[model samples]
Target: MNYRLKLIVSFALLISLAFGIGGTLLISSSYYSLLGEEESAIINEYETLQNNLMMINHFSSASSAQNMQELIDQMVERNMAHWQALSIKSSGETILESGDQSLILNYVNSTKEGTYSYVHINEGSSRRLLLYSKMSTKNDVLDLRASFDLSTSYKQWKSQLRMFWAIYVMVVILGVAVAILFANILTKRLQSLTNATKEIAGGNLSMRTGLRTDDEFEQLSRDFDIMADQLQENIQQLKEDVQRKENFMGAVAHELKTPLTSIIGYADLMRQGGLDEGDRLTAANYIYSEGQRLEKLSHKILDLLLMEKDTFTLRKISMRSFMEQILTTTYPLARKKNVNLVVSSDDVYIFIEPDLAKSLLYNLIDNAIKATPEGGNVKVIARGIKGGCEFDISDTGCGMENKELAKITEAFYRVDKSRSRAQGGAGLGLTLCKRIVDLHNGNMVFTSKPGSGSRVVVQLFGNMSQEVDYEK
Candidate 1:
């Protein structure tokens, strides 16, 4: 059943149960007490009659006994009008009978002594109450009995019960009417609530249950409305985020296409085969430089995506040897600018992805060498750190300001645009390098100041903790 009906029915049942229990106790107690009082009177009369008959027997006269019985019967009739019926018996035979007197015989047999009392129910009718007794005297014993008609008492109580039931019937009729009235009102409210809920479920956030009753149900309705409002706000925010990501993707496409278009155009001019060696060489140089820029852009975008996905593996490589090889490869670039590229190692060894480690070292060293002026020095050092390997590259170069250094690893971000371009770099090398290190669960840090120097440190974690060997 619905909640409101359940509540009303529950309350009504509680009241009905209370009434039923109380009525049963009251009716039962009254019935038993009435039966007890009748029995008491019968016992008293039988005892008195027994005493008088015994005196009459001492006189040895039937006339006197009969006279005494008459007088006692008359006295009983006068004093106890509440007694419904009476009877007299002698030697197991009825001398006088009244009001279902066979009921008296049953009690006479049961009360064989001078006097006794008990409740006797009529056969086939548990509802009827009969209180009876027997008395005795000398050899010619008289059986005196008083019979109280339980049907009389039961009828009286039932008449009162009939009146009570009439009132009870009227009460039930009124209760039903009130129940329907309340049930209707509650059902209507619930139907409205259900309709509003369906609309809200169909994505209409504006729909609301406008119940204003100051109760718990009203509070729940208000809470549902608030939750719908918050849901709407969150959906709108997600839509805006999707739009922003789309715009950023378009911007990135345009940026990457610029270098590719330049490189392709230069390559086509060289392929036309209408130029001297000098012109061909120049065209080739343009194509090569633009190709490098395009490659850098492509690598940066790929790195950013990969970092988000975080798919990388650590493979065995010697950090000391890796740094030395990187220095040897970059020696020509430093020499061309009349700068010294110093390579040093504390002989650190660790297992990691060789390519990623190489890229990280190359990015930092290239940045340092490019920033260094003529006759400046770029120092590269690799050593063991706590359970990891560290590479520190420091250059006495034209370092970045605090603001520029903070964004140094951002794609396409540079302190001096033309200087970075002239140095054959696309400003993505550091960003890609940082992302690759991050994928290996490593960190990259930079220390720099404008016009003084710059230092970049990279830490690659050791394999000790990642020894969940697949081969095993």
Candidate 2:
């Protein structure tokens, strides 16, 4: 059975059993107590009758059956309303009898003297309490028998039993109705939880059991909501991770295909043996340049993959020397691009993984130089802050729009795809730089306007800086 029905049935059965037993006991006890009182009164009356008969036999001075008969008649007439019958018998012969003689016959004979015996009897529609005794008379031993009407007491008992059952049935019915209502309320909460579970299983992760019973069920509902929230969050994260992986793979394939196609076409031209020496040299140079670009792309992709899975050690490095080295290395490129390079720093020791840190600065500087027009400025500045260091790389190049700045750190995302490809950019530079910043427990912020130059800010924290020792 369903839980609601089971609860109802269980409660109903218990109530009925308990009430039936209690009511039956109460009514039966009351009836029996009343009957007992009536029986005591009847016994008292029988004893009084016997005492009066003995007084007549002792004081009347009559030793004859006729005298006894007359005295018994007078006593019978005196209390005719109390008894159904009264009879006097001696030597197997009845000397005096009044009222129903059949009542006397129904009673078993008691011959022993000085002891009275009583019994209850049902005859037809009437009930009787029979009392019998043998008493010593003036001239003979007399057996006296009497029957008292107990029909009223029996009727009262029957009426009480019927009334009690009627009341008991009503109480049981009301109790069952209350039980059903209570069970429905309890099971309603459980039903809501069950429905929520089904909805979540069916891909509705936002389902919740909104119960507020101020009890254990409420606590359970809260816990269930928490579990659902966690599950939805984990599932969303998995989906995002999967989509990212797919995008990365597609970008990798596209990058490889371009280089491979160009290299193959040039090699096929060389193998055909129809081109002049200059044309052949041109094909070879094109093949070599594409090969170099492919090599750079492969290295950048490998670095990104390794960064995801590998841990690096950090060591203290002098910021002044680090910036000088970066400027010197990128000076050739900046000169070739005809872009001005400016540098500034605070002479502080900063913790970094040296090679990765250099790579990070190189990518940022290279992108800045490439984005800048001829005679435009690319500036790099580093300063020590509280417990850390910050680097600001700003370019007076053809900067980017706000929209492009938002997606610049996504893999293979380029602001100007043709210009980027012509400049031999695979669009992984900022993606790789972002990953490096994340590894250092740093934050990267990009602010740009369409015409105005863009600025990239890198803030590295967590044991990032100390004062340089000039005395040493």
Candidate 3:
């Protein structure tokens, strides 16, 4: 059904087929070998029986012919139960006296010179062993044969075959199970990787194949996760850069238009040819003021453009004084909105890029001030954590929902884009902060509840000299 299952089943079927073929070959060879051994044993036994029978004839010839039949019978009986003596009239082919009269008559009737010395004694019995000879001093001769049935060897071979097949089946079953088990384990790992890849292809970068074993599948899983993580980060960065460029363009246009509009209005008034000297001077001053606004907008645009690039470094700075300086700079903006901006920190010295770090804190505090209603509160807090520092910016503002917070870090994603722009931001402020933190090997966490408030926490690991390899 699946790739993994296909591989597993294919392997299992191969083993089963191989076992069956090998077992059939072994059984066939062994059966024939057993049969050959049985035939050889019977042949050897018959040859020995013929030799013993010839010896009996010698004994009978040496004895007296007075009670010839009696003497032969007595001697044959003493020799063995299966052998018996007999007297025969060879010319008429009749038995005169014999311990086995019917058998002697049958042999005499069937005998002819130059016939087989050993052969089957009966028409219906192929297993019979026969030895016939002409009489030494009489026309009568002696005949002897030993016959056997194959019932015993047949039973033994059947028993052996049954045992062999039983063991064969058991061994084959175990072999098949082992093959299937290994195949399934390997295939199952591959299946997980395939499914995870599909999810990743569909833009679900969080999907991962969590393999427990140390093998090719595990290596593949690690590679896939690393690839997905890199891809996710690259896509995020590209989106942010593109959005920042767009927003920078828009803000510059708007900012330039405002100043240019005022400048053009003042110039037009002066060019009307009827203005007083004082009024003309007033228009020049207004144009100058508008032109300065253009300068301010240009500076902000430059800052936004730089934020789209990668530059993460640290400069030795006091964490407490840094927070104080940011507050001093942004306090006027907070006062304009009637919002209380509070700053607190655990005293610590941090090595950080002051410009970028200041930009980060400024954006957070500024956003909080704008979002907070009149008389509302915005707080900036910093602390020294284990091996790192923690910065938190919180506001009693119209917060965000879970769905909005989830994608808040995504570029160009703003709950209030127009309001954010009017507040003198490119909306790349938080996104830039996140990138700078990432470059510093740090993390950003956003916690928010609609209508309640929002808190943004930034955790930046200390630039400590240690054996910890970030790549690992």
CA lDDT scores, all candidates in order:
0.70, 0.86, 0.67
On residues 1-472, what C-alpha lDDT tens digit does candidate 3 reach at each position? 9665676667667766776677767766876686567556655654554444445445655533344445455545775324333343434444345455544445533455423244444344222333454433332344433333444445565676677678767866786677678777877787788898899889898887778788777888888888888988999899997886786567557656766887898899888879988999999988876676566556654665675574555655677887888889999999998998889988777666668777777877887788889999998899888767789999999998888877766544568877764554444557667766765578888898878888999987757343322210
**Any idea what lDDT model 3 has?**
0.67
Q: lDDT at 15 for candidate 2?
A: 94
- Runs in model 3 deviating more than 4 A are 1-20, 60-248, 268-274, 318-348, 357-472
On TM-score, who's better, 1 or 3? 1
Residue ranges of candidate 2 with Cα displaced over 4 Å: 44-81, 87-101, 109-128, 131-145, 164-236, 307-359, 373-377, 381-389, 437-442, 460-472
Error (Å) of candidate 3 at residue 336 is 14
lDDT of 3 at 256: 67
Model 2: per-residue Cα lDDT over 72-181, one tens digit each: 66765776338888888777688778788887785686557978988778877678888899988777788889888999988988888889889988998999999999
Q: Output the TM-score of candidate 1.
A: 0.62
What TM-score against the true fold does each predicted structure earn? 0.62, 0.75, 0.47
